[model samples]
Target chain A: MSVTTIAPPANPVERFLRTDRMPHIWCPGCGIGTTVNCFTRALIDAKIDLDHLAIVSGIGCSGRVAGYVRLDSFHTTHGRAIPFATGLKLANPKLQVVVYSGDGDLAAIGGNHLIHAARRNVDLKVICVNNLIYAMTGGQTAPTTPGQVVTSTNPYGTFDTSFNLPHLVEAAGAVYVARWTTYHVRQLSRAIAEIFQKPGFSFIEIISPCPTLYQRRNKMGDGLDTMKYYKEKSKVKNGAPTSEVGLDKQGEIIVGKFVDRARPDYRELMVNQMHESLGSRFIDPVAAECEEGEPQGCEEGLCS
Target chain B: MNADPRGVLSGTHFLDGDHACCEGALAAGARFSAGYPITPSTEIVERFSSRIPTVGGTFIQMEDELAASIAIQGAVWGGAKAFTVTSGPGFSLMMEHIGYAVMTETPCVFIDVQRGGPSTGLPTLPAQSDMMQARWGSHGDYSLIALSPNSPQECFDLTITAFNLSERYRTPVMLMMDEVVGHMTEKVVIPEADKIEVEPRRHTKKSPAEFLPYEPAEDGVPEMVHAGEGFRFHVTGLTHDERGYPSMTPQTQDKLVRRLRSKIDGANRQIGLYEAEGLDDAEVVVVSYGITSRVAQRAIELARVRGIRVGKLRLITVWPFPEQLIRTLAKRVTAFVVPELNLGQVVLEIERSAGSHAHTISVPHAGGNVHRPEQILDAILEAAK
Candidate 1:
């Protein structure tokens, strides 16, 4: 018989990942990995400079993203990633900072930071992977957990109203907001790419599958079944009012670019106000002392 | 290294300890600060907010102390010297981030204008109750440098020293100021920037290929590469290896924790700073720090007039404890009288170091106010007997 020749599948995005840190802590059929794949693809599509990019994450399954990324990364303490990224972005305006974390991390313990960062319209790209449960800590109830879902903490079923994430952030003054499920990889990747072009606070919520804790406990079949359900239920309504986009248990999912508008980001507002007030004496703080050969040049290790 | 002259307010000025601390931070090349409004400490940030824009820096009033504490670390990694200011309640909120700073080896400063508190007990009053909390507040075994400033002048001078020590060691340094010193006004002479010696960050000369983020050099301190110069290094709060990647094994944890402590402990002599006076011939040696030290100075003078040979050991840097000096003095002195604004904090260290070589006496104060001179002199008189 003639010998059959086949080429190995190309994984071009491997350079963007810390392959040495793999196999990651993510379990089998977890949607976090899928979202990461889309993120890497978006970075490529956006042609973002990998050198000037930094990833910050808080405590959760998704917080491990910082450790697995082959870039300037920080795995900060619980709920503090947004403020940490805020400092990074404000300190070095040349660098693009991203805060990547989970539902419980971004919406529960970190909820205050989430709204405030958006309110400031800090130039940060925030990716919140909403798996509807605290998967890493054995499926505890998250602030975003849909109503009547059986979580570890809410075994009798969750009674409180869940957060409408897009609405919350949009109302808090985010410049761009979008929602997509893991089933919509192309759409998610495009949305992330669009975020790179936006100047102010941009947020993308990815509804992901947690097969081990969330799906297994809720008897929602397996990861594949969840994906099929997502494929069937999601309805794209671009620029739809974010107030009506709340998710519910076994309900229709509104998925699309819900909010995209313009507002001067934190830096822009700061620059304008300072320039207007100080006039001739105004100094661009971001470019101030760090440049080489300047009066306060930070190049010769002087900044510390 | 000389500081940037632009940040220096090079002249004598009447200022409070809080404002003086702010001027000191500017002169030390701190280009970024994040803080929340807190009693006694708010003036530092208030001055920084207005002063930073003109001096080419950024000062953000974060949502709370938790954000303010860690934001400074983020700025440090972004290639700027940064700090935060707070009091007891805010300092308590910052313990977790302080641990994060230790684990990541991010060099920064935390100025705690201390107030009385187990929990917000005295917001506007002076207290040194948080001294132990400064050393052991974060839930982990770690060592840090702490400086106690007794006056506005020391606030300016020691604030610069705090920044220098933090840079040299690559660890968080605490400028422990009680509300008395934080709010007290006095003449602060700010020297020219070129005259102010500042320690530069230990940036790695090695290329990205050769550099490992957590690799310690000959001095047991790692070289740093801030975010965005293409180093692409990683920093985490978890137990990590020299590569700065998390490794959860017990072996990694042991090695990391031991090194974090040993780095500062090995250089304790170089780090310990204090003023020893009249110890050559003395029966009772008084140990004190912060505002209480100033009060103790008066007590020593009074004790000397009362025919008791009293000596003073003023601790400028309190955390590394100056155990060598305490141990040496304990050998000859009849007793050690330790007075503090707190009930009994640093006195415990004196008791531990003296360990039957000398009598250890705790002149405790409940801490709504500074100790009266007679209160310490009474203790000194008792110790002499």
Candidate 2:
């Protein structure tokens, strides 16, 4: 008997990507695609049920990650990816939910949800690609763009103070917080793997390049040049207080695992509290809780 | 499919409209809800958060209505029946997601227990003012299903209907309740799990290798496969072909947008729900919905008692607006009187349906409580005259 052997895929990374949709919409020398490459690598390395993996992204260049990945993904509305993932995770706790989006979608328009998700410590992995500008809408000003940076909306140079994201998420109660650039692919991918298992809110901010508009207008050089700059300027300080980790326009970019703590995620706290309050009368509503009747030991005004 | 017995509380009980609406959601197969509570609508989620843990689902008190609205859509894509509840102001905040849901052809429910509002006008009061908003609030030329339940029982009944229609058509269904209906307590008999029919998710049967996410069946409705089901498909709010990728040509826009309308519009006849009484040779008719329907019922009784040839048409499905019925009745009736808690909303639909065949009168109220039956009676008398 003769057996036929199939040839191995030439580009291993293509297995995790929707390569047919490529050449992606990302501009030349853009760092989003590079960051996504790291993400797909991390997702593969995590070694979980690929069938149960779900990726959610908001509106932006980074939001395109959800579309490119080979998992069950959602390119949700602007600034709402966190909440959407929140619902998806709570609905099916077994889903390995990941939220990937841009800084503007996460910190600017979706800032409220960002903080509250961290505060609630919802169990999910957030990969925020901070390109320092809103690259999709023609390089507009973003909440993460460093001070005095020029964007379409800020042609006269930005006057608004940017958010210190590592500090923000830590303050908001994320269990794991890390920062990396596309230059730090190995570290970023490693953090990505770690975040998958870290319960509660886990945020990974990848400072990436927007050579098309942001770099051209600001004269920050092309993607590779910016990557070289990140290599020289980034100082890895794992375990440093997040407060000491703000990125300066011309100063060092502090990149590391800044915060990792043990705390109950939203589902854990919610389920535990529900069990404590409602006892055995309560079950996961999606499980076997469909039948209805008066409870044996009912509290006034409860579901019974 | 029948409701899961555990989620279905099969017995008669005294409950408010808000609680009944929540029960209806459970029976309809909704096991996930993301909500930020507002007056009159809070109890729906409050009860859901408690009951869902027992029945086997999850509820999150979202940071705001924006999160609440989109979160449910995410859950839907994650393979769960999901919904969110809010009032007028929260509904306004949710308009963007509603439009997104329409564009993406996601099946979910939006419960708007409306309060008086131009902008939070009456948080604790009743109003049907959102009738127009529910129809056209989301930007773009598209059609959706909107249901109005008059009593606590209908709140349960119509909520299930909303979910069924949403699943059947793969569109977001709106359950429009007023503070009056949401807060009022009454006897509601929930049926056994198997007795209640729900439209299960129309999942695609073809293997993942051959599936096109947005490709509809002959009925102009598409099948949905949840995320994590190994169906590698992309869905966006952008205009796309069957594969659900972004396509920006006017041709794509025309084909896509037209199909969005035609699905619900094509089914408008079947989708339209209303109650008709005493229209054989009636000279005048009263059209109302939600709480105003009940009030109009009272005025209708009085009008018949006074020998005014008046009839009642209570709208259950407000959108797709029972137009054929209104148009046919318009030909026979002297006039149509619309009494609403709003200044004027659904009356416009009636007028359009009536055209010049019959006079259309609107009995508008600013909506703190409800329309006084006498006010509706007076309007009927005037329209009759």
Interface Cα RMSD, each model:
0.8, 1.5
In terms of docking quality, model 1 is: medium
Q: How well does each candidate superpose onto the true structure, as a TM-score?
A: 0.97, 0.95
Q: Candidate 2 has what TM-score?
A: 0.95
lDDT by residue (tens digit), candidate 2, A1-304 = 9999999767767888877777789888888888887877877798867877888899999998888877777888999999989888876666788999999999999999999999999888999999888888998988888888888998899988888999999999999999999899999988998988888899999998889988889887888889899999999999989988877676799999999899988877876788789888867443342234413112311233
Model 1: per-residue lDDT, tens digit, A1-304?
Answer: 9998898887988999899998899988799999999999999999999987999999999999999989999999999999999998888877889999988888888888899999999999999999999888899999899988999999999999999999999999999999999999999999999999998999999999999998888999899999999999999999989999999999999999998899999987888898899986876775565444433324323233
lDDT of 1 by residue, B80-106 (tens): 899999999999999999999999999
Off by over 4 Å in 1: A1-9, A294-304
Off by over 4 Å in 2: A1-9, A285-304
**What part of the reference interface contacts, as a 0 to 1 fraction, does candidate 1 reproduce?**
0.76
> Top model by DockQ, which number?
1
In model 2, the Cα lDDT at residue A152 comes to: 92
